[model samples]
Target: MRTDLLILAGFVAVGGYLFSQVWLSPGDRILAHSYNDHYQFEWFLAVDTYNITHLHNPFFTDLQNASVGVNLMGNASVLGLALPLLPITLLFGPSVSFLLAVTLGFALTAFGWYWVLHRHLCAHRIAAVLGGGFAAFAPTIVSHGNAHLNLVSMFLVPWIVRFALRLFRTTRPVRDSVILGLLIAYQALIGEEILLMTAMALGMFVIVYAFPLLPDLRTMVRPFLTGIAVAVGVSLPLLAYPLWMQFAGPRHYDSLGGLAYVTNDLNTLFEYSTTSVGNLGGTLTSTNYAEENGYFGWALLILGAGLALWLWRDRLVRTVAVLGAIGLAFSLGPDVGWYFERTGVPGPWKLFVELPILDSMNVGRFTFLTVVALGVMLAVATDRIIKASADGGVKRAGVPLRLVWAAALAAALVPLVPLPLPATGRPPVPHFFTSGAYKQYIAENHTVVPVPALKATGDMTALTWQMATGMDFRMPEGYFMGPLGPDNIATNEPPPGPVTSVLLDVAKTGKAVQLTSAQQADMLAELRKWQADAVVVYRVEALPQLRETLDPLLGSGRQVDDVWLWDVRALTRE
Candidate 1:
């Protein structure tokens, strides 16, 4: 117990060190590599906190998309985590809460795997620590740690795996099924994509593990099927509504298009990630800093293969190896690429690219299953080494076998040690929001149309400002994924209205255009549709031009507390 506490403390220390940049000044600094996703998640936390406190619907909000509203369940809102951390968000603000979520997310995930390995798999505690550490802090996991709280909060995964294995052997199938069902529901609320991937991986494992024991499967089939049925019965009731809201309710989207093209390059499987200690010159591939999902390094890959070969007799080792290989193949996506060039080779994922749930996922994340496979292999190998050492040791060619194995493990892992995530100082929220000045100008549930309004692709500063105000005012056409086009496919930004398109163009080009009377009438009509109360422009390079552009439609604006505002309640009022 004492040793477990120490190991957990070590994990926490590592997690804290990795995020110390934002931890020191949560509100003022942001993860540079998050690329505005930090603002999006902070907005999620703030809105969830506000909704919970005010007794509003947590699944939908008019806060970002204004009168049209955004379906929170359709987005990666992470309400499962947000609701639990409400006190922290309420006290220290969402920035602090966001940071805490990522920081502790890593620690808790590591500890969860550690507990699983020590209690069920490895005989030695240190072996479990190594395996668990790799499972949680692998390069792929660290990449998502940039701003993907939904992916980072994986503490439930190991427990889910443990319970799943128990179901195959448990006498008390009813009790175990209920527990597993509850866990599945919670994990679904956290990140349904992750849960889906886990289910796929578990299914593959069960198939592979049961193949050799097919003759005895008849004995295990009854309990396994019964437990699965009961588990489904329990989880469906808890998840039915939220699942409906996500897929069939207001603002629901069919699927995100073009994600099938975003996949891992073949070389990514053996290269070092930018965040890893072993990176020589960084990657030359097209993957962005946050999407380097398969950089396992050559040493780890070779070591994993060697370990699997050495333990070939063990069914578990063979099962994990097959799983990892399949996952790696799938991660290559529809067309396999070699040295960042398309090879025109169809990978396994090509067959499933158009499937309902799979279409929405970034296929490169299939490498997550590979990470789990490697962790299991490491634990099993380490257990063998410890047992060999204890039982008078196995010698090969008179070499010190234990010492050689230890050195080999270190060689594989040392290069993969993670570096601190990059961060930069974020601009402070405008005084207009912090002083609560907007409340006086904007009526309840009325929109504040920000100049250069939050779009899917660029500048999300407005989101931080809205979060700073505790989501007190609504905004039009903000950064969030929602249904669009004839098919209602998922798009990051809603279709821009006539006025919004011109504002966005001005914000992008810094060139003002004169609006004719007809255009002004269109702008007014759009504002009326939004039920807009005010149009506020904060710090932006095109502020002057934007003001000139809006003048004809909104009349001359007045300066107020580091912002220019035009109160349009008269024109927009019903």
Candidate 2:
């Protein structure tokens, strides 16, 4: 019937198909099992639960880091996302809520693109659909949908771009300025990196677009300035504290490290993956299965090149091309590589590496705009075909030019269509955490020191434990961003402190290591230092040898509800 309804139905059907595993899973099976999902999203849910219980202040929390705690904004401060999803978490549990947000993020993000292309840029609804679909199902989007909620939840990005353009054209500057401001402020909370990418993309667009209209630039300057003022005014209230906290907070740090490994290679961008069509044997050069953003496939690249060539004079096409080039350049990272081969010729990214705010960002994420630019190019190409035929002048090989372009577009998109995002079965959380047996030993302000305390590796499922129990108790080690140790690196992998690190390494190796009296004394002192009430060992393959090794040093632990726990409160009392 209507274009909006058609777009809506398409978004739901395709987005649902991609995330079918999550939506169709039986009862609590929709749990996030990815590395970041299990650790990061799980902990955020616990933080959200705590925030709701204690008014709306979400800056710091005791769930992670315990005493020093974690500054929420310094990390992935998803309060904008978490607050809205709170009802779902309360009703269906945190895992379900996480899956829901992820699944819906795809559809909403695509719809945002559709709205921009259909309402602002393209002449044909079908053209808009092509752009939106490609944007939503881009290999990179599905790659991230596996875990990273903030990256996937880019529904606001296109709108931000759309309104920034609206400022140049709108007579009602005040209204559009307010809209742009709200979008920026909300995006700052959800995807600050995405906002930066969007700004970069828009800047590239305006630089080229304004050149052609250089004489008219002064006419557009007032509205543009008004939009910026309104955006900063509206966003400053919420963003002010978090920006300061990230830079000046007690636990803030300068470096997060591992900058080179996350770089994108030119060959990797041309490569396909398990998610995309044309092949199932696609491989990745990025660290793991989760962070693969390189694939744009052969089909889109060819078709996009043709469109850019055909519409070379078009402002939007030129702007998209410039933005994509910038993304590719930035994605090369500080140490440039050619398809996994390090060339030793440093890229432009090295300049930004030493800069304050830019250094903290993952260099790999710049490719996000390349995907956005490609989607817009596809829409522009489709519209050109529609126009040539509607004018009754363009024909190719006795066929209407529109039909030819349409067939080519279909050919490109069909072979490159991506599969659903893959899902994995979650490991069971312990009954000690789930059954609430921990309540007896641990209380408010007291901590549960999970044995091994290896948060990213799933060995420290204590974050899940806190989320399961609605965060009734705090835990020492967890998956969160914080400045830690003497050098003060702000990272997800904070040291497990002295005590947990020694025990954890030995447990992982299953080695018989003699603990000296001094070592035993240090462990006990660390317990007191942490203000811990208890320590828990969740059922794992390494538990048996770990227990044998730790019993003599930490004293007898009680086994209850599928967990062995040491009540260290009495021993740690000063």
Candidate 3:
């Protein structure tokens, strides 16, 4: 018990160190590499809290995308974590809540895996700790931790794996299955993509593990089938409505197109990630910092292969090796790449790329399964060494074999130690919204048109401002995923309206275009269509140009508490 507490404390310390930059000034700083994703997730936390406090529907929100709304279930809302942590958000504010969620996410995830490993796989506590630490703080996991709360808070995964393993051996199938079902439902609420990937990995592991036991499979088949059926029966009721809202309901999309192409380069398996200690300021093959999913480094890769060969006789090791190899193959996407060039070879993922749920998945995330396999192998090997040493059988030339093993493990892992994630200053919310001064200009059920407009990409501080106001007012063309066109294809943000397009152009180019009479008329028509009550512009890039663009259409504007405002309620009144 003392050792477990120490291990948990160490995990928490590492997590705190990784995010210390944001924690130092939670309200004023954001993860630098997040690329506005921090704004998106902060808004999610705030909006979820608002929904719960106001007794509104949790699955659908009109706070973003205005009257058109956004399907909350269709996005990575992390409602399971958000709803439960409402008190922290309500007390300290959403920024603090977000920080706390991510920090505890790392600690709890590591601890959960430690508990699982110690109880089920390892006799040596240190072996479990090392394995769990690697599993939770792997390069891929740390990379996602930059912005993804849904992916970061993976404490439930090991528990799900534990219950899944029990299904093959348990006498009380009904009770265990019910528990597993509840876990699955909760994980679904947290992150459906993560749950899907985990299920796929588990299926692969089961198939590989059970293949050699074909004759004995009959004895396990009945309980396994019964457990699966009962688990589904329990989960379906809890998940049915949310799943419906995600797939067939209003604002839902069919698939996130082109994501399957974001795959790992083969060289990424041997390269050092930018965040790792081994990074030497050279060419990095990853798509971006957040997607450095397979930067395991040459040392770890070689060590893992060596461990597999040394422990090949063990059924568990053989299965884990096969699973890791398969996972690596799948992560290469539909077309394989080597040495930063396309190999023109069809990868394993190509076979399943067109399947319904699989089509939506980012193939790069399959490397997560490789991380899990490596963690398992590490724990298993460490346990074997400890047991052999205890039995006085692991000695080489009168030197402890464990000493040599520890040095080799350190050599593999020390280079992969993560650095603190980068952070940058956050733009402060405008006083107009923060001081409730906007209420004087805008009416309820009317949208505020932000200058340059909130968009799916580029300069989304408008989202932070909206969240600061407790989502008291709505906005059009905000950052979110929603269906577009007749086919309901998923778009990052709704197509920008005419007024938004012009404002965005002016914002980007820093030069206002002279609007013709026809263009002015069109802009006004769009304003009326949006039910716009006011136009607010904070300190944005190319502010003068934006003002020049808006002046002709809205006639004039007045400075009001760190913002320029043009109230259009009179023109839009029905």
Model 1: how far is 106 from its true place, Å? 1.3
The parts of candidate 3 lying over 4 Å away from their true place are 280-283, 391-393
lDDT of each residue in 103-146, candidate 2, tens digit only: 67888888889888988875588888888878877877777876
Query: Candidate 2 lDDT (Cα, whole model)?
Result: 0.75
lDDT of 3 at 388: 83
TM-score of 2: 0.93
In order, candidate lDDTs are 0.86, 0.75, 0.86
> Residue 253 in model 3: shift from native, Å?
1.0
Candidate 2 regions exceeding 4 Å error are 1-3, 26-33, 259-261, 390-394, 457-460, 485-487
TM-score of each: 0.97, 0.93, 0.97
Candidate 2 worst ten-residue window by lDDT: 25-34
Pick out the ten consecutive residues of candidate 1 with the lowest summed lDDT: 280-289
